[model samples]
Target chain A: MNLLVDAFAWIFDPAHQAGANGIPTRLVQHLGISLLVLLVASAIAIPVGYLIGHTGKGRTLAVSLTGGFRSLPTLGLLIILALWLGVGLEAPLIALIVLAVPPILAGAYSGFEAVDRRTIDAARAVGMTEWQIVSKVEVPLGLPLLIGGLRSGTLQIIATATLADYVGAGGLGHFIFVGQKSNDYPQMLAGSLLVIALALLSEGIFALLQKLVVPRGVVANQSTDVRRPSSRRVAVVGFPTEERK
Target chain B: MNWVIENLPLIGQRTLEHLALSIPPIVLSFVLSVPIGWLANRYRWSRGVLLTVLGLLYAIPSLPLFVVLPIILGTGLRDSVNVIVALTLYGIALMVRTTADALGSVSSDVTQSATAMGFSPWTRFWRVDLPLAGPVLLAGIRVVAVSTVSLVTVGAVLGIKSLGLLFTDGLQRNIVAEVATGMVATIALALVIDFALVLAGRMLMPWTRTVSPKRERRALPVDEAVTA
Candidate 1:
């Protein structure tokens, strides 16, 4: 389609190729913010999630709080944060971090829930230290779900990081918003394509990361379990299993 | 705070608008995704492709999708259908796998026994499978409900009316109170819907009430809202 051609053309145009506000600069800014938010969210969520999962005392908070967090409007939060904190990076950064937290948090503790009880019981029978057991046994077994949380959080931040433009922060959203304002359909499409590409690329990279770190036994199970490659993780999230016996 | 207190009626109206724009897509998608979910669960071959496609669709950003919808549907830029249709697409993407998982969670042996007892397929689904799958399906629905309510605010980006207008209007006008109110209202609405679904689940399946909300939620988790 001509629209498609125009979009590609706009992306490749030389005039748009080199500058402070150029596409490449925006792309780096976008990815930088997304990566920073993902790290911060992981830092805050992973340890707490691991503790809660290990203790099994906070499943209620995990379930209900994430449900609440999932629904907080990101754009609105950006607006609110910008109003209170001044129109700058801090607002969008905070807003994006809040958006990124719930999944990472859920993935962690729930991933612990997903751990095979026999595995943990085996660790205890062998007199493994509590910390050693968590680090050596639980976390590895729970890595898939923890990674699932990361996958979810990263994708969300990537999508949302675009909204930074609204708060006077620079990102690909600037292109999209400006394109929308000027009725530059090609540029809008170009920005959308760029964003979608980045998101898909991130997913591929994470999938590779998941494969690299997943324990061998789980990796074997992953190939067989087709519904959710992480069926073990799903079983832990809240499905009831009936005893056939 | 004083302005928000004096403007209670406007707040109520905007909240209602928010719910109206949000709730329909959840119900509409739930009704439609059930059969699609059923098919996905029933067909082993299609399951992988189905979930992967949906997951990819889920990855599409909400804002761009909002802008793209009008162009794809040949609708006017301002039509509320744009928002409804976009939310519905997202809802279906999120719920189909969850519904499939809920049905999949129903043990095969149970369904087999019902079949052996001479129940027809449709009756078996209605009597055996659907009831057993109810808790998980309902949990997924609640997630969708919470997500939809929150997502409705994004519709304001295109000037689609909802509580999100307060955030936009407030920010543009530098009224932090209005923005704060919208934030509080949106979060509150999400919690209320989540609890309402919990109550509905308990009432529909009285056995669940024995477990407190804490334990019950634990037994049946929901974050396809966030995860998807």
Candidate 2:
């Protein structure tokens, strides 16, 4: 009880503040690392996903590998990366990227694969280039599921970012790690609260993004908003807008 | 190569250890989730609350949960119980939604006919509702099983002596082989578990096999009609 109280106090301690007000420095550092990780991972994974999803062959292998990647332990990966990269932020960044890639790749592949065959065929019949068909037809149709994958991946990255601190990469996890080491309960709780807050906030933001990007018409038939909690009326018109006939 | 030859027995032991940790949680979660899902389905209001709580539980990270549990419950497997509890919460979140969705998917006419024929509510649920919902529910369980298998590796970080322990220990000791072995074992175990569940789902819900036939017939007409 005393430990918990003290930990809270440390979180609000004005002198130790890392940012504006009493916001901890470690949290900012961790969030930055996590963002960097996500950006890098998405850069690599999205293209790979697009390729594998679009290509008819080797998809099973690609998907299986992605699943394998997802199951790898973040902490263990970080430890190995830390050894290879020599600690600090880089090791955790590598680990987070590896962790984040699989979901994004899977999401992209599944989303692209799910694009209605008729829609793609119609797009091609209308003289749209293959690239244009993918960009204009397949991607739009697959947007919701793709965004869902991204949302899940982002939340996962934020949660696992805490482990970065264990490898001396320094994030909000630092507070928790420090608290655990020193038995400072309040600091640990404060760090944890911040991590959860960040995760929830990201989830909300991504959910909103998914709603905005997904074709309004497609979402209307679904009862559950798999992406966001907000009930917005998005218009989803049935495919083949009639002119193709 | 040399390491493989030298530590073959130890690698085998670690593999077994990993399976032991991963398997029990999945089985326990599945066993518990089914009953909870059934109960939740029976009570509409409680179902919503249960689902909300379980969804929130899914957001909690394993590491912090482990750390907090030891503080609250004291050391060892008592602390490890947090992982089980959290995993079970996740199981309910996923399984309940799937169960509810599956049950809802059962045609109303089927239920109405059953009721009209004087079948008791209990009989309707068991003989009709459950059978129809079986494939979808099993699909959900398959997902949960795979997730739980992966999650159980996290238990090793808290000193549960699973594959995760091997990785953690290897990292701490700077023994790359141990970490590699542990990771390989974890992946292999996860795939095996997932395959086993897929097989089980197939065996238990035979209707899923025929779904492709139904889908294909619909697809043919739609494609020809639309193309024409």
Output the worst ten-in-a-row residue range by lDDT, candidate 2 chain B: B71-80
Where does candidate 2 clash, by residue pair? A7-A186, A7-A187, A8-A186, A216-A234, A216-A235, A216-A236, A217-A235, A217-A236, A218-A236
Top candidate on DockQ is 1
Error of 2 at B68 (Å): 3.5
Candidate 1 segments whose C-alpha is farther than 4 A from its true place: A57-59, A222-245, B199-228
Candidate 1: TM of chain A?
0.90
Q: In candidate 1, which residue pairs get closer than 3 Å at backbone N, Cα or C atoms, i.e. clash?
A: none
TM-score of each: 0.87, 0.79
Q: What global local distance difference test value does model 2 have?
A: 0.72
Candidate 2 regions exceeding 4 Å error are: A1-6, A19-23, A54-57, A221-245, B1-24, B35-53, B69-78, B109-118, B202-228
Scored against the true structure, residue A143 in model 2 reaches a CA lDDT of: 83
Candidate topping lDDT:
1
lDDT of 2 by residue, A58-114 (tens): 798877787666566666677778877776777787788888888888888898898
